[model samples]
Target: MVGLNRLSLIATLGAVSAQFQKPLLSQLDDVLLETDKTGDKPLVDTESLQAHISTESLFEHANALYELAKSSEQEFGHPTRVIGSEGHRRTLEYVAAKIDSLGDYYKSSTQAFPAVMGQVFQSRLVLGHSVPESASPMSLTPPTTGKEPVYGNLVLVDNEGCGASDYPDKLKGEIAFIKRGTCPFGTKSDFAGRAGAIAAVVFNSNPDGLSGTLGTPTPYHVPTFGLSGKDAEPIVEKLKAGEVVDSIAFIDSVVNTINTTNIIAQTVEGDQENCVMLGAHSDSVGEGPGINDDGSGSLTLLEVATHLTKFSVKNCVRFAWWAGEEEGLLGSDYYVASLPEEENKKIRLFMDYDMMGSPNFAYQVYNATNVANPTGSEQLRNLYVDWYESKGLNYTFIPFDGRSDYDAFIRNGIPGGGIATGAEGIKTEEEEAMFGGKAGDWYDPCYHQLCDDVGNVNATAWLVNTQLVAHSVATFAASFEGFPERETTKAAGVYEKDTLYHGRYLVR
Candidate 1:
């Protein structure tokens, strides 16, 4: 809406009206030509582009997405845009419609890929003759649907079951009992399966109820479930006393490969060889509307892209709405892996925006200080730092721990950085002092819950982060200037191979 009038004016006065006698939207080339002749603003300026960003515009998109999810719940079975659900399909259509309304200022396309998605229908865990206090199935775990409930003596694994030696010969034909720590639930499940265990159960390190993922589906993984530490304590005490503990673990689930699409758009006018890419996952976890977990990030990109159509750029700007990020960054991974080398080289930098409106917020910028970071990542980080300093805003750095959609970009030796408010991480006193939120509360108490609806977003945090998004995007779209070149040497962190992100939960 910001540049609609200007575009109409161009269509009315330009060749479309005078020569062809049509009301066609003026192309970027014509706009540039007109700018050159009239000595008007040509390349996109940061201030004007950013001025289009407003809390009203950002939340408008957010509310639309929320309403879409809520309305699709009866058909989809949940108020979610999860990868395979009808809600997700509608979400993609919404994005496509928005891009189409931009006329010909940009070229938009979509990529489809087959991805594995799992759903658990039922999970039950019983110790001895009674059930535990709480039992939740680990995501993507094998289900014991047709088979009898797994019946075996409990085999308490040694030392959290992170290594091969942790499971002894006694684990054979038994249920592995392990503690969660030092490794992923998948690793423990894998170890249990390799040790010939019938199934696996991992208790949380804390006293809270456990909800976890086994990373991705694997042949070596066994049916796994997470239990509260409080319930596991009594069982651990009985096992230590050499008391025989009989158990039954059952999970009814389905794992299927489904086709999903990722929306991609790029400005038709700019240096295609040095493109600046920005992305956010479009799909949410299967719990809620995800209005803040990533709806904030998605709408921020949408709002920015909407306003971006009003101007021209020197370097091409690309926007991606990735699908299936909740299932271990599947959409983004498929995208990066499918790119040809020449096309991949065209990307100058990739900026990821995942969560931007945490209820209890703190300004966070990715610090590409990990082994996977390429040469230019530090410069990108510095750009964000400089911007925050210029605005007199307090900010913090988060490690590139192979989380979020940036993992694929950084893994391929492309420099990347972006902003987030926060997620399940707790706010410290220092952050509270700067951001003015409760010191000990989770950044987003509604993270991955049914309550994460339109009301969960912190409007001030969302607006500020969106402003940063506009600034960085507009700046890069204009010129790369001193940005770093892509490095050919591939770097892989030691932990990168095993680390899987399930809504900020490390699933390694």
Candidate 2:
């Protein structure tokens, strides 16, 4: 029950509740608007909530989550805190416990999902049918292994190997050398394999011979190698010269079925019809602890939710710690699909945060207000813009192109927006001048690698982004009156996946 004194104070003031000092009360009255139609829950505007948010509190919460992930890694002896792993399980429990400690102010629960989890991968391309040389693995359909390398004669498959006719009958029991082009690596590789080649080698379309992704997985393709064009030309020329040389191509990877849960928590006292949803992925990639990839995001939300209990909310604020995001945004997708129509309709807007703190950082705000955005998305974008402008910080806009978990919500027409530092994307000199990071370097050089542990986070970046998260949540929970109404129809031309991503991040 709420304190009798607090109720009496609100009754007397007509719009206040917290044990505020004179200055805070004066500040609250100036901004907190009148109650909604029910008049049972009054507004607790952004200013009042921002007053409670401290950089110190954010770091405390962030460090807490990092410690949990590190503990999970040390305890489990695994390189990552991926979904269904022991560390991931403990991390989920920690988040649940934090939510529970809010004393029933927020109702919390776990939503579970079963997924075909792909773990680590190992690949090799042997030379002279003996010692193997280094080669990159393509994203889609990494070969299932334990089969010995196929020592096949090499065949030059030109025209991007996009068609069966691209590979001649002479390709039987041979390794098809294809060029990357308009189609996906998976398609090219699959076509070559179907044409009777035992293996496929995709050389670069660019001068440097950049590695490529198959885009999606397929069972038809055999072991594939993504080699630079430079590294592959000699062999190609040799094969063309009718030099009878045999090569061995091999790959080893693991695919397993795993169970994980998405943690959902919401304010018990707010209006159920107009819910404000916020989320971040809780699972990490297999290569590292993923502290920056998402621990920064999930913990930031946790801190906001924990502090929110100190005040009242007019609209419900729901928090989610999604699992299996690194793999394919699986947990968020599952949750969205499971919601009843009415339940889905209740979600007014969703704001997501992923990879908000990279050691080499720049602020990246989602372009949710732009073309193809859902209704109310613009308001969320404006909120961040207004917030950043207030601080005189420069932030770049990243396309809301379904690169993250928000895809599931927005595709169903729920308006959403969020912040990110960056992933594997390279930073420009312009960004360097604005945010002071190295130009031409990846925003997160350690992204998806073994170094993305607690040490990978940029402290200043995390705090600033997290504080903005608090301000946004407080603004909506107070009243979403200024935001536009949401449309129930599925969004048209929503962010679709590239053939390579397929709604999941291509963990290159």
Candidate 3:
């Protein structure tokens, strides 16, 4: 990882250059005109456009679907696997319904009982208070019945404060106020519980409200809740003044099994010997409608698949809409791991799209090492960045972190890449000046919350990012070199030999 000083210096220089540029739409027009003059298809031909939807059209379709999802009270609470709740089944059914409506354009598949987990937040029975209108008990929170009025001083635990053997003892009987950092929420809660803390409160470290799963359930026992910084400020002040505080925590949340589906659409215009896979998870965390979490990517790919089938492309383009991603990439990991080795090797590239609609998000490129950069991955990133720069779009490059579905591919050395909009972190002063959001605010505050409904999407950002993804898919399908094949029997034999040697010598 690059040091903060270096990163800041680069960003400062980049920001200065980013300001003196033309509009992106104007640059797109120029590129389209040039491509047209070079004998490429015109951008606005009815027949051609119909044959393949433009990126803008795809964004519109995504917005429509997002609206459909948002308006359906039935579609709300479609939580899958995380808490094993009925909401999971509802989410599955909703996705399956969408795929079914697409007719023969898609094929459906499932991976059963994928290992999925998330954080827990319980209500202290004694501390049971009236439920806030906006907040609910976090999924996996333990059940409580006691109603004791627990009071203690609030202690702020930083990233380094967790996990010490004596640390929990220090906070015993006190209310531990922790910052969201380093470890998952589960770890912090577990630590507090072991130390005899009465209750726990967590707040977002950044300007944006803390969102996203904590990845696992904490084994230790305690009541927990996430509070916005605004809600926590007064509590922090009261603690400083040595004021004894009293509050109730009401947790009535339950967990059960729910069904969700993975939507797979295919275009078989060319030889089916090898396939190019493009995927994005369709499910969102229960907090919000997920218009941007994946609505942007899903809609873009849906439009791409819809149009590609109308053309005579040489390779197959399979679009997969996964489920249970917020529960730790469950759908894609299950699907990929279950595939036979022979079938797995047939995949050329896995293009994943998670978030591509945050107007304030920086444009990022995944830096994959060891494995060669496939035909259009690097080109796609550069093309989008250059396109953004030419049009003077304020964008930044974030280092690759395997936090999405792309992890499945990278683990197996399958070449892959995609795009994302910013999440729950503030844009710096430099970024704010270059971009258009407040410096202290996150790119999207509604991320993973109920506020992330259809209305939260940024249409312009959705349009441009979707177009970039569409363009990359189209170009890669037209010209991807085949992947090198590994002989299974020989590979297995080599593996066996290595294992035997290690067992015979290393173990002894």
Candidate 4:
């Protein structure tokens, strides 16, 4: 019986040697055998055990964790702000509790929510006739209230044919009908506002489409709304008939006090000096529950932290679940900007996981152009590619587009990279053939919308990507070489272009 047990151990050791060349696994085997001889369970050698854990097994575990997170999202429903009127604090508490259950490796930090909200603009439009359906409130525009709906006749103000001052006085108490051309929308709107016009409806002149915001937040005293080109032609025709048209307008809605929080957790070990940072946002837009939008990435980070705690990595790994990402990357930007110089410099590399689990999703790599460029680092990009290829997984290089949390890191000149599943944009026929997704469809239809629930994700794709991230993380943490220190610069230059791609400057 003893000989058989010894033989089994020998086979396991031999397999480890044949599979991996790293010395850590051999050290782990010695510890395991010593425990067997002493009639006690031996301490697992983290480095060595990591080598033996097959990629398939790691992916399986990662998939299980993804499903678990998805279930939690369903059970918890949408997590809005807790302390704020939105009720998202419960979600923060729930996330903290989950990290706590994983034991002592996680720590939580409570940050004060900053005050930032959509700006409210007052828009008033008087028309020649009652066209209620033709005029609905824009999505981000606030509603208005007043003593009376400001009424006026629709006057077609052609800014080019007529002078800029040829409005309002000609049709006071009547709508100013304007052709959409020549001037900026905001400029036309401002001109109309000064002329005492109740509202200005700008229609598209071209066939393609005219969709844009009214520049920055403008405080127009009168309510304003954009009219689609198709909807405005008939109204303009009627006004041109020299008919008197009167319409009322008001926009008095408050867009204030939306709140969000950032969730941070640190590992248990205090002695680990070097650090690896992993992050993903936890909040979605007011659209869907964002299960796949970011829940996939967030959960993957959680599972990686959970498994890594079981194995002792030499460096400290910080896991961040950021909030207000959909609100224009507010949370991450705040956190990075707040980090002290020393701590910021210690962040060797930032691995951002935004949307990693889209089914039929394209695999992309960031920071891959011009390996010799000073703005980006080829070393980190090559490290990621090598790790993925070693595991026999497919991946593609994607240029940094300033679309995710990595933007904050790159702005600070830190080496940043991440994986993303496609979103909003269509995958071309060629891309579809290579990636096996339907062409002419968005990578994610529910992006920033209310339909981004659990059903929106491809479970199989999510599983594979999550596992790939885990493997990449483990490899980078274990064996990445360090870069020489460079002097920091204070100029507001493009960090990604100069430092990330060219390896030139660091933001001070």
Select the stronger candidate by lDDT from 3 and 4. 4
- Give a tens-digit lDDT track for model 1, residues 1-508: 2244455665556544355444244454455454622125456777778788999888888888888787668865669888877778888999999999999878999999988878887778899988976888887888863745878999899988999999989899899999988788999999999999989999877787777788777788999888888888888999999999999988888888899999999988888898999999998888888888788898999999999887778889999999988887888889988887788788888999998999899999887753546677788788889988999999999867767998888777777888888888889999999989999999999998888888999999898888888888899998888886776635434224444454455574
Predicted structure 2: lDDT = 0.76
| Maximum-TM-score candidate | 1
Give one digit per residue, the lDDT tens place, for model 2 in 1-508: 1233343555666554456556665654543443333333445666666676666766676666656666655645645677877768888988898888878788889988886565435567764544434367664445534555567777888677777788898887888878767676778877877887788877775556455445445667766777776677677778778887677777776556678899999888788999999999998876777878888898888878877876778789999999988777889989988888788889999999998788879898888864566788888998999999999999989887777888888878788889999888899999999999899989998898878876788888988888888898989887878788877656434444343343444322
Model 1 TM-score?
0.85
What RMSD value applies to candidate 3?
15.7
Task: Evaluate residue 310 in candidate 4 and report its C-alpha lDDT on the 0 to 100 scale.
Answer: 55
When summed lDDT is taken over every stretch of 10 residues in candidate 3, the lowest stretch is 499-508
Task: Say which candidate scores most in lDDT.
Answer: 1
Off by over 4 Å in 4: 1-87, 118-141, 145-253, 268-273, 367-378, 391-393, 397-399, 482-508
Clashing pairs in 2: 186-214, 215-500
TM-score, per-candidate, Cα-based: 0.85, 0.82, 0.61, 0.65
- Residue-level lDDT of model 4, residues 187-228, one tens digit each, is 565566667666655566643334333332355523456666
User: Which residue segments of model 1 deviate by more than 4 Å?
Assistant: 1-41, 76-78, 129-135, 145-148, 157-172, 179-184, 203-211, 227-242, 370-372, 489-503
Reference-based lDDT, residue 355, model 2: 84
Prediction-by-prediction clash tally: 1, 2, 26, 46
- Model 1 lDDT, full chain set: 0.83
